[model samples]
Target chain A: MKTSYHKLKNFINTPFGVILLVAAVVFGVEVLVMEFLFVFVPVIQASVPPIAFNFLDAVILTLAVSPALYFLIYQRIHADAEKLRKITESAQDAIIVMDNHGRVSFWNEAAETIFGYTKTEAIGKELHKLIAPEKSLNAFNHNFKGFQETGEGPILESVREVMALRKGGEEFPAELAVSALPINGTWHSVGIVRDITARKKRENLLRERERELTEVNEYLRNKEAKEQALLASLGEGMISTEIGGEIITINRVAEEMLGWKEAELVGKKLIEAIPAISETGNIIPPENRVCLNVTAGACVGPLTDDTSAFVKKNGESVPVAITTTPVIIGGKCSGAVIIFRDITNEKELEKTRRDLLSLASHQLRTPLSGTKWLIETLQREIHGTLTEKQGEYLTQIYKINERMTNLVHDMLGVLRMEGDINPAKIEPVSIQTLFGVITETLGNVAKEKNITLEISKTAESSIDTDSLLLRNILECLISNAINYSNEGGAVLVETKRDGADIVFSVKDSGIGIPADEQRQIFQRFYRATNAKTFDTKGTGLGLYIAATLAKKIGAKLTFESAEDAGTTFFLRLPASAK
Target chain B: MNHVLIVEDEDFLVRALKDNLVSEGHSVAVAMDGEAVFDELKKKKPNLILLDLLLPKKNGFDVLKEIRQSPEWQLIPVVILSNLGEDSEIKKALELGANDYFVKSQHPIQEVIEKVREYLEGKGSTKVGL
Candidate 1:
């Protein structure tokens, strides 16, 4: 009740309430005046009767209040309409009022700006025909027919997005909202239209970015799958680890070889998960592990070894030829990749080869030895004296036998060196003693060739190396030098200290190697063209055997030669062999 | 005269060795295989035994082991003359108490006689020739 009283009090203070109150007071005063005249003025009241007097008073009251009511209510309503017009004109959206006939009845300032028309030009124009695209006009006309008849249509009182034509005849996306209004019993539509071209551009750009992101994602997934397939298809057991030797991936071969699942080994330190053992059956420590060493950046080269074995999950050791390479990225060691193969079959094959070679050597040497003793017996003339012609024939046979013996020895030496079965036995070797032994071994050959063999020592140094291997290499070099020398040509076997290495060079003033054939001189069974022609009985395996032995003892065998001039072969050995 | 026993499978090598030893003024006994070695040893204790590794009946390693184990034959010098020239085989022969190890193809009959003379004269205990 209190709130209603307050509201009534507030309403009475309004202009319309004041006008109503004044009209009501004026009617009451007119009624009181009519009553006084009827009661006091007897002559007038008798001539005009009571009803006529009341009607006269009502006429005078109406005439007095008419102008006041019009002044107050009409002026207030006009002011309100003007305020609404100002608001509509100042809006950013185009505001238009369309009459029931579909013609623009009211055009605001925004509408003129949006439609490229002055208010006078737009006011009487058909709104849809003027602004709607040609494609949309049919639909607009169909909907407008219903609106014209009932002031209601499917598009009325709803927001919709439509293509609109700008002043320049360019179509742009726009948001439109229409509301119906009744003025003087005629339906008019108030429309709010907003240009949405910028919004639509933003949406299109967003969609384009989304599609690109999806494509990039697909490409990455494909690359990852390809890498996975490559890893899976590898024949060797492969393991990839992080910088700390933690296993990141293990391929199917590695899993099967190690008897461990990928999930079981991943994230575990490789050294701990699969222990490596040396040939002597001692566990290789973590710091000595090739993968860890590579990951720690301590090792730059790929470390490979065939004697190492990895202990499987079942405690069985499998011999493997393993190579561990660092995965370097941007000059930094990121991780390590270990590729290995089960070399058990290879080892067995090598053993078989070695056995076969050994057996062949023994079998061939037995018959050769028998022949050698028989020839020696004949040369010694134990049974009977030999004639001069017979002696010459025996000498020829001896030479051929000697050549056969040398060939057999060279072949055996090559087999031993190639197999790497005979490890170097390091000992202190006197350079002078080595030279003396080599010269003596080749002295007979040099004498037969009429070549002068000389041994000169610049610096007498004892080198720690395998005596047998060094002897074999020097003997080969000295013999080659002597055999290739021209008659009476001098061959020099010299040794000196070159830095921390022992340099043994055999210089011969004989047919030098051709420049093109020098590279292939160290290959097995390769004889220089001139050397072959000069000595048809040359085995062609001397330098190859020498090089193989040199390599076994950590020596570098190099040479410099000029065709028809001379060739000098240098064997450089570290003072303390590794 | 020092009696030298030639234990070899090859007829030519044995003949040459016997000739060389006999020419050097030593009586020669022949054992063509590992079994003949013991038969000859049982009949007469040779001053020195020339052993061949790859024998017909038994290998030289087992023959040498048995010779060294026997008190009567242990005193006799055993020399290995074999075509098997690998270091391991040589080492095995020497480790079995052979007085000397020589790869037969790598040594001439004269060198074998020289070695035999050195042993018979009590001038050499152990020697390896390849």
Candidate 2:
């Protein structure tokens, strides 16, 4: 089972056989000389002294000399040879030696097992050809040339990571180490090899994972850059403010709209940078303003109900439409973003339209007053006599003029609502004062329709409000109730405090507004569908103007109505509104 | 006859006011600008001044402010007649101490004349030329 070079060493050295030859020669020469001398000189020994001699003496001497010397030296050499053969063949790593001609001169049993080849088949074959079939010849030729010229080549160290051929023609990764030494006056290389397939596969997998991670990091960085660019390109006047109301980022539109350069305003407070004023002429500090239309607390949507006048760099005030959304991160409100547009031109145009409407309404008053005067003058002069038909025609003309005058008055209300007037015109107006005004204004209308209108209240603080506008709003609501009421139905105006807001309600037993049309009643040019069939003259602008003024003065316009259940229109004005 | 001076830029409305005041037994003198107003006042000191807000040579507020600054015309009542009935304009006119302010659209020609009569009578202007 072992490939032993000891057998070869023994055959070549012949140590034990040479020792046996010398021992045999010395034994033969001693025995022959001793016997020749005894047989040739017997007469000389007798004359010297009559000595005793026997045949047994020569036999004992030959026995003692010949076999003893041969057995002791030759047998010991054979025993030491056996031990050397076993040690050389039993190593764990594959060991093979190649002669100077690239042929395998020595192949141990371990080498045969490692290569899946028997020792007999491996020995005497070219070592490179057995391990690497295709590149073996070229590699051997190159390495042999290098060794011959430079006296050195690759030593093939232990377990090197490279492909080696199995007997089945498959290649697996292996580790190899080689050493060159002189054997019997010829140079040879002894290679020690080991398989390393599992270790190499693990290294390749680790490198691939590292590459994947690097690619993912590169992709995320690019995506974040593009998103940042998109945030910067928004067209509206975009502004981001810190929680302390300091401006952080101002977009191009915002910079132009506020008339401030980016460098001039970034760290300044919004109020300091751009002092804003309400339509009512009150200055609103930026920190107190609420963000509108924010959804899910992220503050990424449009603002609502944002009307304020921004102070320009030159101290001129320009109206703007502003929208603000809160910027929230990690479930907390961090800051807010505001978008706005300059609306000065549009506001001016709207003011002009309202001015024209006001002028037209006033124009109607002159003719109306003249006609009333003329009719009164005629009645006073002709008290003595008049035909029934003539009186009826006069009465009809009187009624028509009255209607035209009322329409003109409604138009005037709308015009006045459009004007920019501070509602700080409010003063400590008593509920009694409100009652006196409303009843007096509606007195004539109620008389014609034979309806009773009145007011009731139970409030201590004289409700601070613009008496004139409040009178107009209440009169509209009460008169509408009276006009739309059946004959003999009652109308009542009442006021009281409902928490922080003053509650003013007008209740009337009348043709109530339909439920579905209630939402649209406060809209401009919106008339109730049921009211259209009642032959009542309503300009539809009265309630619209009333509601608008109510809102401007911080009042809520609400109502409850049911068919034939009577209607109640309530105005909840905050105490601060006063 | 009670004398009323009408300082207005609108020719038709000025003429109509003049004719109406003249027919009602009042002497009417008209000026179209601030310069003309002073010239007319030199000829005959009017009992009342009805000044329009808009004029060619000067605006009504400026004329009023100038007339008010003068010691000679200090006692004369100047009523502002304007088509710009804005709240701020009205406030400014009142603050300037005009006797009254009226929008042209708010009154008829006859009613405006009647208002002038009521104002002049309330002042008790009995002296003829002064």
Please name the candidate that would achieve the greatest DockQ relative to the true structure: 1
DockQ of each: 0.43, 0.09
Give Cα distance to truth, residue B89, candidate 2, Å. Answer: 5.1
The global C-alpha lDDT for each of the candidates, from Candidate 1 onward, is 0.83, 0.70
TM-score of chain B of 1: 0.95
lDDT of 1 by residue, A326-428 (tens): 8888988888999999998888888898798779888988988888787777777776899999989987886677678778888887777787754688999
Q: Worst lDDT window (10 residues) for model 2 chain A?
A: A290-299
Clashes of 1: 0
C-alpha RMSD for every candidate: 7.8, 13.1
Docking class for model 2 is incorrect
TM-score of 1: 0.74
